[model samples]
Target: MAVRPPVSKSNVFLLMVTGEIESAEFPEYDGLYCNFSFFYGQDWTVLSNSSEGITQTSMRGSSPASNFVWNFPIDVTFKSTNPFGWPQIVVSVYGVNSLGRDEVRGYGSIHLPVTPGRHSLDIDMFVPEPASKLQKLVSWLIGPRPELVDPKFVARGEGREITRVSSQGFVRANVNIVMKDFSKQGYRNGTERFSNNSS
Candidate 1:
């Protein structure tokens, strides 16, 4: 298991996903059409105080953003709309840890301008989840598995990555990726108002 920063009451951390389609409650599992599973630690508060009637707005520019400005529970999936039509295909997380330290981490964003239709989103168990040495050895012996990636992506270091695509008709972008150090517990974020506008 990846070491987690110690937990305490001094912090109120959160992870915000800036994407297209304005905003959306993180789907636990979309089944098949678009299965986006929560891959990392489930404790990162998505909306510190998210409640019904809380307004989430998006203004798309270079990259689409579905910014969450509220807080909600750990298991609840909050849903909102992309003011510009299409959803922010890319996703990342920002939050603070139990220590009250501010931090930002990036995960690979998936974009499929082609390959129409929904795929599957699984809470990626390959990374952060703690496993015994035997389990790791067995998986290694089982050979490798194909991973997903966004073709238009550019790595920005510090776990940050970005991708862009022009509309080519009838394709819906679905991303599912776990960033390095995502849920390492050592990660933290400074809580402040963020804009969905991308650079």
Candidate 2:
């Protein structure tokens, strides 16, 4: 018998970002709210904008710490390709202002699951800290410290941090990822079957 190539299993990719974000730089000591946006790079489109379209947290007053809890779940699909090559989830954090425009505090990214299963990552939010004039002058004369920027925070096609004259602030949080395999659904003579039948 002729040898046959094994079938590749198809998987549905789903990512969820659930965590608390602590603010340190913003002036609002109390009565602070935040919103988050998720981007998967140019190649992919974000499905269903997670819960409530976008990740918007309720107004959380500052007490022990300036923190906001958010739940952002996204559904993504990719043609047969290596999961490792998929771009990381770009999470842009912003502070809601009352007068008008929202302020961009900082940004952070996390790697997706390499395999077809649930995965999780604990990542600290990175905010930029302003540098002194002398420090900037010296850096301009010489070179900047590579250690100041974390690779995870750098988005694809974006070279260097948003602000060159700044350092990173850390806010601890956990990121969870859950992958579903919808391809394994029962099939009968090319027709799909559902667990809960309407007819």
Candidate 3:
């Protein structure tokens, strides 16, 4: 009788983020760029080579919508103890200022699918609004807000262009990913950093 080798417990998955923003709320009209990152529980992996997230889809003209695809796909290997519990994809949009400072125009997050297959997702962008004195006072008295990014900025609709003045409307984008799941791979969790987009 021949003996069979045991399958390893870890799983590998490839992640791809498609870039698009139907509309973005900005105080001024200027060129725009986007950055993206993937977070698993507490641990995080950037989709870019620089400390900042991946730089992509630069809009030269004054426009709210951007449709560009990030050619690079990130490969991540982790323990698939609970495959259902996948991470979240966070996106940050920035506007390039004349002074060389980049201001955050919007932020958003989308849940990643755990099942191994190609999936398409629509992620809505959330733009921050300046708070009133009373709102800030009340929040301070109660306690610090939970999220680093304000929750009130979350857009209500998906793939719609926002044109409200007070609301400083938001936008949505599409992301397509082909997640290839592999078992018994040589790579292990914590063995090495996932990848550097620069390389």
lDDT tens digits by residue: candidate 3, 49-135: 332245554443444453433433334333333333356656666665455556565666667654333455556565443256675
Model 3 scores a C-alpha lDDT of 0.45
Weakest ten-residue segment in model 1 by summed lDDT: 27-36
lDDT of each: 0.26, 0.42, 0.45
Alpha-carbon RMSD of each model:
20.2, 10.3, 10.9
**How many clashes does the backbone of model 1 have?**
29
- Leading candidate by lDDT: 3
Pairs in steric clash, model 2 = none
Instruction: Score candidate 2 by TM-score against the native.
Output: 0.47
Off by over 4 Å in 2: 1-53, 97-100, 128-153, 161-199
TM-score for all predictions?
0.20, 0.47, 0.47
- Alpha-carbon runs more than 4 Å astray in model 3: 1-28, 42-52, 60-78, 98-100, 133-199
Question: Per-residue lDDT tens digits of candidate 1, residues 60-175?
Answer: 23323322222221122222221111122333332333344322222223322211223332211111211456655754455231222531122222332222222111112232
